[model samples]
Target: MKILIIDDEAKAQSLLKKLIADLSLKVDQLFTANNLLEGIDIIKKEAPKIVFLDIEMPEYSGLEILDHIDLEQYPFKIIFTTAYQQYATEAFKLSAVDYLLKPIDPDELEIAINKALKIIEQNRLSSQIKSLQNALNELKVKKIALEVPHGIIFAEPDEILYFEADGMYTNVILKDQRKRLICKPLKHFVEQLSQNKFFFKPHRSYLINLNYMTEFIKKDGDYILLDNTIHIPISRSRKDDFTALLRETFL
Candidate 1:
């Protein structure tokens, strides 16, 4: 496998390279480019399987790469690297685009690489990039992409009742009483939906949208009842925080 890293900062480039090495990915060739144009040139010539692209470039943002390269023709997965925070980062999650925040963590890098491999195999990179571009340009995105075995599900955040962990998979329960089993784990959703204030992880095995929570039971066990009439337990450690959040929201 061939991999490329594009970033203006030499330090960032070096750090990512070291991290990739630490992860021990099966990379036959590892390329680096200082800027977007250079990265484009490398892409055209080398055709790496994966590209760790820096979004905040001097001349062109990483999204601008879409303007240069025809993704349909040159189909390679992109793992965006960005220093942008809050709103901008939210767009990435909403679009189901893989991104690493600045001062990247090794675990995130590993996860992103694994995801890119799966997407490349499924040949679903083009639509994801299009959605990401639209989200960044518009600066507001309400829907999120959920990857399942058959295909991807694009759904509004409010439509989700809660996420339940089933070992390696996550069961996403919708308002319409549909359960979509996702390939990724619950922890992935927790991080992806962290910015969405309504979603709360009351237990390690589940993440629930607070808006769907209809009742809280304290006598029998710490559990929350959602509008869908499903009981989700609140972890002992998270009980105080969950109660406080409920008070803050309803009070």
Candidate 2:
């Protein structure tokens, strides 16, 4: 398993290398590139399985490196590292394996590496990269690719009715009332579905697509009734905002 770190700051690169070394990840070879051009060259030649990319760079943004590389030819998992939260949503839009906030936490680094390894093992790199490219170009991404235990499940946003939180996993309910349990949490879906105006998180445990919203029941904590006869609660704090949004969009 080859790992590459692409960051301009020597200190940031050194710290990341040290952290990876200390954690004893299954890295056969570790590579580093200071800028996007060098990183592009190394990526073309070496083809590392995982890349710890710095979102912000001096010459060009790390995301620009994707423009130069043929991801279908040399697929790799990206784990974006950034000092700002503003880029977190954009990073997720890229379908990155994970985004870590710097100065990096060892536990988070380990988790990100483990996720990348899983993705590499599944060989879904090409599909994820395609999704990322679509998002980067601001294209209408109709399908959502979800990684399940067996394989990847590609679903249309409209096919989804709502999401229910179940401990570490989320239960995805479709328009047909069929449910699929995924390893990702509800928050992950919230971020992924943010671009679609129909998906809204009215409560901590649920993410409902307004397209399927049949009724807003005001009794017993203000829950929403969906086409599938499923009821999702709206948090007290978010009820007013959610109702206002519903009125503005539907009424």
Candidate 3:
């Protein structure tokens, strides 16, 4: 991942760089620009994934970045770094952008980086979906692309037993007992696979393929047993509806 820091103050630039290193972020290239123009040049040339832009600059303030570049055309994540508190309101007006106060907190910086990574991953996932659709049309088979840090994996929807939510990522459990970690939330997969009749959300964090369900146990608490023998809870609110649907479909 490429990161560009656009701040005139040398100290601020160094501090941010140090903090990023300390946090152990996966930044492949870290570029520093003393002004917004230089930053824009680097952005056009290098195309950094995340940019730490300072709102207060020598000539062109970071806010002017909106005027300089067509953000809609080149969608890179930006996190505004400024000492002044007043600019926070304006910075948030831009969608999915984060604003951090100067003398940045390590925790906040880490959080902002995570948010940026998620958004970048989402963009990649979107592209992969488009590619998947085209490939499916040509191949005449149903498949989805799972994004990992290394590359993409194409898998059949029926091969996926379930999806488990893990913090900012999701764990995809396959029918063969292989578990693959993807850099996207479970909600994304739920929405992407909503049209498929086999997958159902049994709980907030789980989307299970009904074909893999072996048993629905309701002894002490409601839960489900899958083909791979993993027991996952069924949400109380969804219990009645889920049971009714299971009966209607299977029994």
| Top-scoring candidate (TM-score) | 3
Residue-by-residue lDDT tens digits, candidate 1, 45-106: 99988988888889887767787888767767888888876435543643434878888989
Name every residue pair that clashes in candidate 3: none
Q: What are the TM-scores, per candidate, against the unseen true structure? A: 0.46, 0.49, 0.54
Report the C-alpha displacement of residue 220, candidate 2, in angstroms: 87
Instruction: Please provide, for model 3 over 119-236, each residue's C-alpha lDDT reduced to its tens digit, 9 standing for 90 to 100.
Output: 8899899999999998777564477789988999999988999999999999998888999999999998998887777788989999999998889898878999998479989999
Q: List runs of model 2 lying over 4 Å from the truth.
A: 124-251
How large is the C-alpha RMSD of every model relative to the true structure?
A: 19.7, 17.7, 17.6
What tens digits encode model 2's per-residue C-alpha lDDT throughout 1-251? 88899999999999999999998677789999998888888888988999999989987997676678877888899999989888988888777999999999999999999998898877767768888988875544578776678987988888988888999899988888888989898888888878778899999999988998888888877888888477888888998889789788988
Model 3 misplaced stretches (Cα beyond 4 Å):
137-251
